[model samples]
Target: MTHDLLVIGGGINGCAIAREAALLGLSVLLVERDDLASHTSSASTKLIHGGLRYLEQYEFRLVREALGERERMLAIAPHLVHPLTFVLPHDHAVRPWWLVRAGLWLYDALGFDSSLPRSRSLRRDDTGYQTPLRQAYRGFVYSDAWVDDARLTVLNAVDAADHGAEILTRTGFELAEQAGDHWRVTLSDGRTLEARAIVVAAGGWTTQAMTAMGVPPRGKLRLVRGSHIVVPELFEGDHAYILQQPDRRIVFAIPYPGGTMLGTTDVAVEDPSDARISPEETQYLCDAANRYFRRQVSPAEVVSDWSGIRALYDDGAGSAAEVTRDYVLELHDKGAPVLGVFGGKITTARALAEDALGRLAPVLGFDAHPVSRARVLPGAMIADIETLARQVAERWPFLDPHDIDRMARAYGSRLIELLDGVDSVRDLGRALPGGMTEREARFLHETEFARAADDVLDRRTKLGLGMSEEERRAFADWWATAFPAG
Candidate 1:
C-alpha cells in the first residue's frame, strides 16, 4: 500500500504526528521498532508543565508554547493529566534569593494562560519540605501537572488508529530508496511500503535513522542521561520539591504511590542506547534529596530506579545541562521528501505534530487543517474524572476503590468497555497481585497493544511496583499460556 505518510519512531512526537496527520485525511502508517513508549517516553519524570527551570536559560518562547500545550492537555486528557503543586526551597549558598524569586516570577508570567495557580512566597515550615540541619530560609510555591507519560503516547496512537492509520509495533524501518515521487521503504519484518513522504521522529536513534535514509545529519544532539530513584515515601503531602544543586542543576522529588520519586541528574554520554543507572548517579540523587529532607536516603534504600537519554539539541552550551530542550524539524527534498525530528518536550508534542505536518503538507500536496486539539484523544471525552470514578465504583462494587481509581486514571471513560460483563471477581478470571486480572490483561492485549507482560505491568500501569518476584513469575506463566506464539 502507498501511504501518504510513513512515520518512524513511536515516542510522544511520532505518535502525536501520526494522530494529527491521520486526522488531516491522510493515509498514514506508523512503524515502531519496539512497543510504544517502552524506552525514553516511559522513563520521563512524568510532569506536564513548561520547564520552569528553562526560564533561567532564557527560553521564553519554548516555555510559553509548552505552557499553552499544558493547558491543552488538561482540556483534552483531564483524566490522565492532573494538577501538581511544587514547592521550591530557597538556598542562599546555591543561588541568590532575589534571583530565585525573579525566576519563579518569570515562570509564572510566561505561563500566562495557565489555569494553574501562580507562584507565591513560602516559609521554611510552610510545607512538607524540611530538615533539622538546614538553617532558616524561604521559598516559593507553584502548580504544574503530572501525567502518565507512557499512556499519553499510547492514547495518541490509539486515536490515530481510530482515524484509520495503520500502526505496526516491533516493525523497524531498515532502509528507504527513491521510487519516482514516492519512497520504497523496507522493514525489519520483510515488508515493503510505499510512502509519499516520510517523517523520522525516532527519539534517541534519530540520527542513525537519518543515516539509513541516506540523508546527512541536519541537527546535532547532546545525549544526556537523566536518572531517577524511587525510595520509601519521605513526606506526607501531595506536593513535590524542586531542589537546587550547587552546580546550577535542579532535581525534582515528586510524590509516588508507595515512595517519593527522587531524581534526575544531567550527565553527558556518547550513545543514546546506554541508558542505565550508575552507582554514582544513584548516590547523587540520594544526596540531592538528603540535602533538603531530615530523612536521609542511601543507595541501598532505593526500591526502584530508571534512566532515560535526553537526546537534546546541541545549542553549543558546553555542558549537557545547558543544552536546549526545544526540538528541531529539518526537511530535505531530494526526490521524495523527508522530515527529521530531534529534541522535543512531552508537553509540546501535539504542537510539534502541527509543525511537522505543515512542512509535509505543501510538499505532499495535501491541505493540513488543524483538528487534534478539537478531536480529543481516546478515553478523555468526559469532563470530570472523579464523577466517572464514582460511577465505576458503584457499577463494579466487587472491585476495590483503589483499583477503580487507578483504572480511572489509566483507562478514563473507557473503563466500562474494559470491565464489561464482569459483575464479580470470578468473572475477572485469574487474579494476580496489585489487582491485575486475566481479563484485564486480555483487554490490554486486544485494545492497547500490550503484548508482553511488562507492557501491561510497567507502561500500561505501575502495578509492577507492588508485585513480588514470585507474583511476577506467576503472571508471566499465565500470560505465556494464555497467548502463545502465532
Candidate 2:
C-alpha cells in the first residue's frame, strides 16, 4: 500500500505536517529515528510569541503570522499553552527608550487581532517586577505565552494518529527512489514501503535525508546550536524577563518547575546530531543572568542544560544570531514530488504545516484545502484546565492538588480516561518520585510511545527535574522489571 505522503522527522514541523495531511484525508506515514521530540523540538526556550525582537530585523510579516498562530494555539491547545507577561527592561544607553517603546507599539500593532493585552510601561519600582533586578531599570510589560514544548510535538502526533496517520518513532528514513507516479522508500530497519510523495521535515537532518533520497540540497543549511541552562528560580512572580545583552542579542529567564530556564546562545556548529551545551555557553548564560538579577548564579549552580541545533535556511547572514527564523518550503516537483522544510519555530509550526499542505495537496493530485484552524488538539477536548483539575481532585481525593494539576496539564481530558477504572490510591500502584504513579508510567508507555524512562521523566513531563538521583534509579529499576527491553 502506498501512503499518500511520507513525512520524515518527528519534530514539531514534521508532526505538524503529518497531522495536517491526515486531517485532509490523505494517508500519511511519519518516520523518526528516535523518540518523538528527542531532538530540537523538546529543547526549546518554550515561548509562544510573535518574536518581538524580530522587529529589529524587519520581519513584520513573519511576526504577524506567528502572533496569529499564537492566538489560535491558545484556543486550540489551552491545556499545554498558557499566557505569561514578559518584562523587557531597557537600558537607555544601549537602545533609547523611545526606540524600545516604538518596537513595542509595532509588536502590538502586528498582533492587533490577538486577544492578548497590548504592551505597556512597567515602572522600575514595580515591586513584582523589580524585586530580583539589580538596578530596577524601567521596563515594558507585554503579553506572550509559555508552553510544554515536548508535549506540543507529541500532541500533534497524537492528533495525527487519531486522524489515521502512521507515526513510526525509532524508524529512520533510509532512501527513496522515484518509481513512476509513486516513490519506493526504505526504512532503517530494512523494510521497504511506497509513498505518493515525500516531505523532508527532518529539521537538522533534512539535507542528509534529501541526499539519500536523491534530492539536491536546494538551499544552504546553517546549523546554529541554541543552548539553555536551568538554575534556581530567579524571581518570585510567574512573569518572565527578556534581557537584552550588550551584543544586541536577547536571553529569556522563565520560571520552570523547581528552577528557572535561562537561555539561549547562538553558536555555529558543523554537526547537528551531536549538539551538547558547552561550558562557555553555560558561563555566558550565567553571566547574562548575573548582569540583571541581584541573585547571581555560577556554572556550578546549574542543575540541568540542553542544546538543540537550528537547521536555519542560510540567507547569507554573517553571524548565527543574525540568521532569520522564518521557514522556507522548497518543493522539488519534477515527477514524484518532495517538499523540504527549513527553519521554523513552535509558534509557527501549525501555520507552516497549513501552508505546506495547502501547497502540497494540489501538487500531489489532491484538491488544496485549508486546514481548520479552530480545531482543538486531541488533549484540548476539555479546554478548561481548572475544571478538569477539580474533577480529578474530586475523583482521587487522596492525590495532592499539585499532582492532579500536573496530570491535568499533561494529559488534559485524557487524564480521566487514563484513570478510567481507578477509585483509590491503591489502584494507582507504586508511587515514583516527583509524583509519577505506576499508572501514569503505564499510560505513557502504552499510549504515548514512551520506550524508556527518560521519555517519561524528561519529555512527557518535567518530573525528572524534581526527582532525586535515587528516585530516578528506582523508577528505572522498576521500569526494567515491568517492561523489559525486547
Candidate 3:
C-alpha cells in the first residue's frame, strides 16, 4: 500500500511530525531503527525553556518561538510538562548584575503570554532555601518548564498511531529509490513501502541518512556532544539552579526524581555514535557546580551520566556553544520529494514539525492546517494531575502513596487505563522493585513499544535508579523468560 508520508526516525521531531501529518488526514508510516527516543531524544537536559542564554548570541527569534512552544506544551501536558523556577545567582566575576537583570527583563518581555510568573530579584536571605552559596550574592528567579523527554516522544508516537499512522520500531530504513510518482523504500526486515514523500528527522544521523539515500548533503553538519551527570540531591526545594561558568557557558542543576541532574558540556565530536561523556567533561561539570554551590561535587558522586549528539547546521560558528539550535529543513526534489531536518531542540519540536509540514504541503499537494496547537497529547487529558493522583489514591486505598504518585506522573490520566479492572496489589502481578508490576510492564511492551528491560527501567521510567542490584537481576530474569529475544 502507498502511504502519503514515510517518516524515518522515532525521535521527538519525527514522531511529532507523523502525528501532525496523520491528524491532517494523511496516511503515514514511521519507522525507527531502535526503540523510540533511545538516542538523543532520551539524553536531554530535560527542560522546556526559551534558552535564556541564547539571547546573548542575538538568537531572539529562536528564543521567542521556543518560549511560545513552552507555554503550549505546559497547557497540553501539565502532568509531564510543568513550571520550574530557575534561580540564577549573580556572579559578579562572570556577569554583571545589571546585565543579568536586563536579560531577565527581556526574557519576561518575550514570554508575555506565559502562564508562569515573571522573573524576580532575590536577596541573599531569600536564596537561603537553595544550595548554600560559597559567598553572599544576589540572585534572580525565573520560570521555565521540565519534561519527561522520552515519555514526550513516546506519547507523540502513540498519538500518531491512534490517528491511523503505522509506527514501526526496531525497523531500519535500508534503501530508497524513485519508482514512478512514489519512492519505493526497503527496510532492514525485508519489508517494502511506497510513499509520495519522505521526512528524515534522524537527529544526529541526519547527514548519514541523507548520504545513504544518495541525496547530496545540503549543508555542512557539525556533531556537537552534550553530556549530563546525575548526582545526589544538593538542595531541598523544587527550584533549579542555573550556574554561570568562567567560560561564559551555563550549567543547570535541576531537581531530578532521585537526585540533582547537572550538565552539559558542548564538545565537537567526529562521529554521532561517539557520544560518551568523557572524564574531563565530567570533572568540568563537577567543578562548575562546586564553584557555585557550597556543597562541592566530585566525579565519584556521579550516579549516572548520559550524552547526546546534536547534528547542527554549521554556520561557521567559532565554538560548538555558539552554534545555532534552530532547525533547518532542506527540500530535495531530485527524485521523490524528501525533507532533511537539521538542528532542533525538544522545546521547539512541535513548532518544527508544523513548519516542516507547511513546507512539504506544496510538494505533497495537501493543505496543512494547524491542528496540534490546541490538542492535548495522549495521557495528558487530565487538567490537574494532583487532583487525578488524589482520586486514584482514593480509589486504591491499599496502594502506597509513593507508588501512586509515580504511576500518576508516568501515566497521567492513563493510570486508570493501565490499572483497569485490577484491584489490590496482588492484581498488579509480581511487584518488581520500584513499585512496577508485571501488568504495567506488559502494558508498556504491548502498547508503548517498550522492547527491553532498559526501555522500561531507564527511558520509559527512571525506576532503575531506585531498584536494588538483586531486584534488577530478578526483573531481568523474568523479562527474558517472558519476552525472550526474537
Candidate 4:
C-alpha cells in the first residue's frame, strides 16, 4: 500500500502527526513495533501541564508554548484532560517563599487564556491539616492539568482511523530504502508499505529508526530515565502534591485511580531503549515522599513501579533533570524527505503535530489546513464532564463511584457507547479474571485495538497495578482466548 506519509512509532507524536495528517485529507499509515504507547508515552507522570520547574532552566519559550497547548487540549478534551491543583509543600531545604513566589509569577505570566485557576498561597495551619504533612511546612497551591497519557495516544489513533488512516500496532519496520520516487519499507511481519514521505516519532528508539533508514543524525538525542511508584490512597481530595526532598530534586504524590502515586527520579541514560528503574531509584522515590508526609510509605507499600525514557535534545547539561524538554524537527532528503522528531512533552504533542503538518505541506502536496485547536476529540463529543458522569452513574448506581468517575474521565462521551445496553454492574458483562469487567476488556479489545492483555490491564485501565498476580494470569488467559490474532 502506498500512503502520502508513513509515520513510524505510534507513540504520542506519531499518533498526533498521523491524526493531523489524515484530518487534512492526506492518506497516512501509522506503524508501531509494539502496542501503541507501550513505552515512555504511557509511563509519563501523566500530567498535561507546562513544566513549572523549566522556569529555573530559563526555558521560557518552551514553557509558554506548552502552557498554551495545555489550555487548547483542555478545551477540546475536557473529560480526559482536566484542571488539577498542585500543592508545592515548602521547606527549609528548598527555596524560600520569595523564590517560590517569583517562580509562580513567571509560571502564571507565561501561561495565557488559562482555563484553570491561578496559583495562591496557603496557610500551613489551615488546609495543611488535610494533607499528610509535617507541622513546620507551609505551601502554595497552583494550577496545572492531568491526563490519561495512554488513552490520549489511543484516542489520537482512533481519530486517525476515523479519517481513513491505517494504524497498525505491533507491526515492526524491518528496513527502508528509496524505490524510484518513493521509499519502500518492509515490516517485520512481512507487510510492505510505500510512502512519499516518512515521519520518525519513535520516542526512545528514534535514533535507532534513523540508523535503520540509513539516515545520519542531524542532531543528537539525550536519553533520561524517570521512574514512578504507586502506593495506597494517601489523601481524600483531588489536589496533587509536589514535595521537595533533602536531595533537592522534587517528586510528586498525585492521586491516581484509587491510589496515590509517588514519583519520579531522573537519571541520565546511555541508551534510550534499554533504560529501566534501578533499585536505588525506587528507594529514592520512597525517601522523597517520606520527607514531607507525616505518614511514611515504605518500599513495601509500592504496589507497582514503572519508568520512562525522555527523548530530550542533547543540550549540554550535567544532570538529567536539568536537560531541556523542548523538541525539534529534522528533515532529510534521501528520496522523499523524512521528518524526524526529537524531544517533546505530552502536553505539547498536539501543537507539535500542527507544526509538523505545516512542514509537510510541500512534501505531501496539500495546502496546510486551518488549525483544529478547538475541535473535540472523537470520544470527547460533549460540553461538560458532569453530564457524562451523571449519565454513567444512572446506569450503574451500585458500581464503585470512583471507578465510574475514572471511566468517565478515560472514555468521555463514549463511556455511554462503551457501556451500551448494560443494566447493572453485572450486566456490564462477566467479571474480568481480575478487578476489571469483561465489558471494559471488550471495549478495549474491540474498540480501542488492545491486542495484548497487558495493554488492557496496564495501560488501558491500570488494573494490572491493582489486581493480584493470580488474577492477572487468569485475565491474560481469558484475553488470549477472546482476542486471538487471525
Candidate 5:
C-alpha cells in the first residue's frame, strides 16, 4: 500500500511527526532501526523546562515556545510530566546573584500563565531546606517539570498506531528514490514501500541518513556528547539543584527515584555512536556537584552512567555548550519532498512536529489539521496524578501503596486496563524484584513494543535501578523462556 508519508527514525521527533501526520488523515509508515527511543531521546536529562541559560544568549523566541509546550505537556500527560522545583544557590565567583535573579525573573515572565508557582527568593535559614554549601547566603527556587522521556516517545508511537499508522521497529530504511510522484523505499528486511513524502527525524543520525538516501547534505551538524552519572542521594529535598560552573556551564543534580542524577558535560565528538561517558567526564560531574552540596561525591559513588549525542545545527559556535539547541527543518521539494530535522530538545518536540507537518503539507497534497494539541496521549486520559493514584489504591486495596503509585506513575489511567480482572496479587502473576509482575511485562511486550528485557527494566520503567545483578539475570532468563526470540 502506498502511504502519504514515510517517517524514518523512532526518536521523539520521528514518533511525534508520525502521530501528527496520521491525525491529519495521512497514511504514515514509521520504520526504526532499533527499539523506540533507544538512543538520544531516552538519554535526556528528563526535564521539561525553558532552557534558562538560553536567555543569556538572547534566545527569547525558543525559550517562549518551549515554555508554552511545557505547559501543554503538563496538561496532557500529568502522570509522566509533573512539576519540579529547582534551587539555584548564588555563587558570586561564577555568576553574580543579580544576574541569576534577572534570568529567573525573565524565565517566570515567559511562563506567566504557568500553573506552577513563580520564582521565589530563599534565605539561608529557610525551613525544611538544607544544603551542604560552604556559603549559602541565599538562593532562588523556580519551577520546571520532570518527564519520563522514553515513555513519552513510546506513547506517541502507540497513539500514531491507533490512528492507523504502521510502526515498524527494528526495520531499517535502506534506500529510496523518486518513483513518479512517490518515493520508492527499500527496508533492511528487503521489503519495499512507497510514499509521496519523507521525513528524516533520525536525531544524531540525521546527516548520515540523508547522505545514504542520496539527499544532498543541507548543513553541518555538531555532534555534542552529554553524559550523566547516577550516584547516591546528595541532599534531602524533593527540589533539585542547578549549579553554575566556573566555565559558565550549568550542571543539574536531580533527585531521581533511586538516587541523585548528576550530569551533562558538553563535549564535541565525530561520531554519534561514540556516546559513552569518559573518566574525565565523570570526575568533572562529581566536582560540579561537590561545589554546591556539602556532602562531596566521587566517581566511586557512581552507580550507573549514561550518555547521548545531540545533533546540533552547527552555526559556527566556538564551544559545544554555546551551540544552539533550536531546531531547523530543511525541505527539499525537487521531486518527492523530503523534510530533514536538525537540533531539537524533548520539551519542544511536539511543536517541532507541528511545524514539520505544516511545512510538508502542501508538498504532500494534504491540509494539515492540528489535532495533537487537544488530544491526550495513549495513557494520559486522566489529568491529575494524585486522583488517579487514589482511585487505583481504592480499587486494588490488596496491592501495596508503593506498587500502586509506581504503576500509576508509569501507566497513568491505563493502569486500570493493565489490572483488569486482576483482583489479587497472584492474579497479576509472579512478582519481580522491583514489584513488576509477569502480567505487566506481557502487557508491555504486547502494547508498548517491548522486545528485550532492558526495554522493560530500563526504558519502559526504571525498575532495573532497584534490582540486583542476579535479579536482572533471573528476570532476563524468565523473559527469554516466556517470550523467546522468533
Candidate 6:
C-alpha cells in the first residue's frame, strides 16, 4: 500500500520522525536495513545531555536547545532517560578553575529545568568519595542525563507503530523511481512501496541514499568513528566523569550497564560502513581511562568493546571533534522529493524530527500538525521512578538488588511488564553470564524487532560487554535456535 511518508533509517532520528509524523495522523512506513538502533544511534556515549564540551567550540545555540530537550526527555521518558551528575575534576594541566567554573556555570545557565541540582564546587577531600583517583584536583558537579540509547530508539519506533506507522527492520530501501509524481521505492527484501514524499534519515548513508535518487549531494556527512570499552565496576554511584587526556581530546568514563564504560576516540573515516575502532584507538582509550582512575586498565582487562560512527556535517574541519555536531536537511525535488538528513546527535533527535517535518511541509502538500513535545514514548510516562522501583522489587523478589536496580533504572515502569507474571529471577529465564537473560532477549525480539544475536546481546543490551567467550557463544547458540537468519 502507498504511504504518505516513507522514512529510511531506523536510527533515533528516523524513528522519532516516523513517530512524530504518524502521531499527526500521517501514513508512515519506516524501513531499516538491519536491526533497529543497531547503528550510530546505539553506539553513542549514552548521555542525554547538552554537550558541555561543545561549549569550547562556541556551539551555544545547539547546547541550549539540547539542554532543553534533555529536560523534556527526562520528563516524557522517565524510564529510559534520567538525570546523571558528572564530576569534572579540575586538573592543573587542563583549564584553570575559574575558566572551568565559567564553563560549568554556562552549562547550568543554558536554559533547562533545574530538576537536577545546580552545579557546585567540591573540595579535594570530599571529591575522593566520587572517584578513587584523588590527587591534585578539585571537583565540580553538574547535571546531564543518561539514556539507554538503543532502547530510546526502539521505544520511539514502538510508539510510531502504536500510532499506525509500519516499521520494517531487516528491510532496506534499495532503489527509488518516479511514478506519476509519486515515488515507487524498492526494498532489498523484494518489496515495493509507493509514497508521495520520502525522508532519508539514514544516519551515515545520507549521501549515498540521496545519490541513488539521482540527486547530487549538497552537504557531506563526515563519518567519524567512536569506540567504547567496558570494564569491571570501578567504584560507583550514578555519577559519571569527563576526562581530558594529555592529548587535549576528552574521553568519558561513564557508569553503564553495571560497569564503568570508557570511551570514545574520534577518528575520521571515508566510509561509514568501514568504520570501527582500531587497536591504536583501543590503547588510546585505555590510556585515557587509566589517567583518571587510580586502578590502571590494561588491554587484557577490556571485557568487550563496540564502535559507532557519527555522521558529522562536513564544514571543512581538519579534526573530527572540530566538525559540527548539528544536523542539516537537503531537499531534492528530482524524481520525488527526498529530504536528506546529515549529522545529528541523540540529544537533539526529537527537535530534529520536528524541524525535518517542518521542512517537508511545503513539499508534501500536507502540514504536519505539531506533536511529540508533550508526548511520551512507549515504556516511559511513569508517574514516579521510586514507585516503579518498588513495584519491580515486589515482582522480582529473588533477583539481586543490584540487578533489579539496573533493570529499574533502565526500564522504569516497564520493568513490571517485562517481568510480567514472573516470580524470582529464574522466571526471567536463562541467565547467560554477566546478568544476560533469556526473557530480556525475548522481549527485544518480540517487541523491538531484534533479529540477530548481536542485536540482542550487544546493542539492545550490554550483556556482551561483560560476557566471557563461553557465555557469549552460549547466548549466540541459543539465539540461533530462536532466530535463524532467513
What Cα-based lDDT does every candidate model obtain? 0.87, 0.90, 0.89, 0.84, 0.89, 0.82
CA deviation > 4 Å runs, candidate 6? 127-131, 395-406, 419-440, 483-486
Candidate 3 global lDDT: 0.89
Off by over 4 Å in 4: 128-131, 395-403, 421-428
| Per-residue alpha-carbon lDDT of candidate 5 for residues 1-486, written as tens digits (9 for 90 to 100) | 899999999999999999999898899999999999999998999999999999988999999999999999998888889999888877788888899899999999998889989999977676545445656558788899999999999999999999999999889999998887789999999999898999999987888888887787678899999999998988777888888899999999998877899979999999989989999999999999888777888999898989999989998989999999999999989888889999999999999999999999888767877888868887788857779889988888988888888888999989999999997888988876667898999999999888888888889998998889999999899889888971
Candidate 3 runs further than 4 Å off: none
lDDT of 4 by residue, 191-308 (tens): 8878998899998788889888888668888888989888877776888998877766789899986478888888887877765778888888878877777777778877778899
True-structure RMSD for candidate 5 = 1.3
Range of the 10 consecutive residues with the lowest summed lDDT in candidate 3:
123-132
Tens-digit lDDT track of model 6 for 206-236: 8888788777578877889999987777656
- What residue runs in model 1 are displaced by over 4 Å at the alpha carbon? 124-136
What is the lDDT for 146 in model 6? 90
TM-score of every candidate: 0.97, 0.98, 0.98, 0.95, 0.98, 0.92
* TM-score, model 5 to reference: 0.98
lDDT of 6: 0.82
The TM-score obtained by model 6 is: 0.92
Better of 5 and 6 by lDDT: 5
Q: Is candidate 3 or candidate 6 better by TM-score?
A: 3
Per-residue error (Å), model 3, residue 211:
1.6
Model 2 scores a TM of: 0.98
Over 1-486, each residue of candidate 1 has an lDDT whose tens digit, in order, gives 899999999999999999999899899999998899988899899999999888878899999999989999998998899999988888889888899889878888888888999998876666344443254448788889999999999999999998999899888999999888899999999999899999998887888888888886777888899998899877777888888988888989998866999978888999888899999999999998888876788999899998989878788998888899999998988789989998998999999999999989889988877888666678987758889889988888889898888888889888888988887889988876667888888888888777788888888888888888887888778888888751
